[model samples]
Target chain A: MEEFEPKIVAFCCHFCAYSAADLAGSMRLQYAPNIRIVEMPCSGTIDHRVLLKALEDGADGVFVAGCMEGDCHFLKGNYRAKRRVSHVKDLLRAIGLEPERLEMYNLSAAMGPRFAEIANEMTARVKGLGPSPFRKQTGGDA
Target chain B: MIVAEQKPLAEIAGMIGDCRKVLFAGCAGCVTVCLSGGEKETEVMATALRMKRQLEGNPLETVTYTATRQCDPEYVDAMADVVKGVDAVVSLACGVGPQYLAARYPDLWVIPAQNTTFAGGSKEHGVWEEFCGLCGQCVLHLTGGICPVIRCSKSILNGPCGGSQYGKCEIGKDVECAWHLIYERLKRLDRLDLMRQYREPKDWSKARDGGPRKVTREDVMIG
Candidate 1:
């Protein structure tokens, strides 16, 4: 049997998580290659539709990475993203999709190791859940 | 504004059952302001329904559109071309939206995705309470801006009923007694004299009991 490689899309705030990914690369940290990071001005910019669009477009899993609570450069952008992510998770569960497929993480730009850890963690979680039912049923290109 | 809530996911999914393609219509009016149905909510419902049907081994194709106001003929007419191609339409507006769409496109199946709850406004973020009953009569002036028609459990016009206990209604602990609210408001404004005036029974003909109603203004009518 061929090994399953999950497709994960991570929306990272440019102020924090995105910079952390760059630092991870410079440090030569090992992480899952399945992650595709899309940088946003702030995680708050990621609307529920954008998150669902990623899944609809074939992503097996999705997550938003932002600054720690009360530490957002925009004062409350990360908090807003957190609430939106939670709402999307409920919507996914209602649709019969596993809520675990979506998540939100808080971290600072200096946490290169933590960035790699999250990438690996999310990849492992999605792999265990297997391919998204969307891809399996629709033969969607993700 | 009209306050509404989305129907449960199971109920909505059942309504659209066995359909291959459907149009999800949203209203950018009162429903939007109340967070029940709008462009954002329309997309959310579309995505949810698509995934749900996909899971059932019956994939669904959804096209989404938000009219400026579904109650208006002009806004509903704007979807004529889109409605022509779909098997059904799921309207996420107040009750009026689905009715308007159904009247406009009699050939298409029109389903309501929300339950029209009341005529009210947001009391706070994510919280809404019933305010007006649309009785076609204005009595706020006598009631100190508190509406007994909606807030009171019995819709009493005279005074608090025997069921009022400790400023709360007998219907629910969370419900504040409307008469109590009126009393406090009137006392604060030094308008206690207004309460002494006996109000006659409301005219039922002005409300829904009169059957379907319409308003035509001679000045505004144009050929």
Candidate 2:
């Protein structure tokens, strides 16, 4: 049987995580291929509904990558994103989903290697959790 | 504003037991500002319910609608067409919202998705504090706009009692003694004399004591 390669969606902030991803690409950093990046205006704009929709639409794992704490381009955007991410985590847990399936990461534009590391880390974590129960039920895209 | 919070998803999900489809009705009134019920919340809740049921392999279907004010019949009436064919209506408004829905739709099973907490406003972003007990009486003038009936731990009309310490209620350090706030506020206004006026025992009949209260404004009635 082919082992489960979990599908991961990363909501990346343009100011930081998006730039970091670009840098990682420039540096030719190799990471897990299962992760898809959705560049957001700011992580603060990542809505709770959008995050849940990602999971419900069949993504095995979701993460919001924002600027470092107290270092958001919009001053408190990252802080807001952090609170929202935590709230969504609670929502995920309330629905019997493994809360670990979602995460919030803080990275700077300079953190190319860190971006690659996060992709690999998230991929491995989701792989460990296996295809999400939603995926297993519907045989959704892995 | 009436402040409220969403009930746990598990509890909400439990309310619809075995129902394959449901309509989530959200209010754009107080519950909206408090972020418990609104268009977005309605969508989010419906999505959550669908996903939960999907995971269980039952796959619940959902319809979403946001009323301008669920407490008002006109808005509740707006849910009329949308409520058809659904096994239940999950009202995301405050407690009053579900009651109104139930009253509007006889035979429709209406469930409340939020726990209506208090008559209050936001303290800050994401924080709401109860400020009024809705005792059906106004005492804000005497209390210097600080409601002793609700904010005071004992609801003492003439208080601060001996339980007040360092401006905090005996109940908790975080609870500001409502009477203390009243005293300070009145003192600042140079009306400390009002504090000693010897408030008579409040008339209980004017409040909830006589059962559910109503104000019939005859002037607003149309022939």
TM-score computed on alpha carbons, candidate 1: 0.93
What lDDT score goes with residue A103 in model 2? 96
lDDT by residue (B1-223, candidate 2, tens digit) is 9999889899999999779889999989999999989999899889888887887778899999999999888888877799999999999999998899888899899999998898999889889999988887788999899998889978889887999989998989998999988999999999988898888888777778878888899999879
lDDT of each: 0.91, 0.89
- lDDT per residue as tens, model 1, B1-223: 9999999888999998978899999999999999889999999899888988888889999999999999999999999988978889999999999999989998989999999999988888889999998888878999999999888988899988899889999999999999999999999999999998898999878888888778879998778
- In candidate 1 chain A, what residue range of length 10 has the lowest lDDT sum? A133-142
TM-score of predicted structure 1, chain A: 0.95
What's the DockQ for every one of the candidates? 0.66, 0.72
Q: Compare the candidates by DockQ and give the number of the best one.
A: 2
Indicate the worst ten consecutive residues by lDDT in candidate 2 chain A: A133-142
Q: Clashing residue pairs in candidate 2, if any?
A: none
* CA-only RMSD, every prediction: 2.2, 1.6
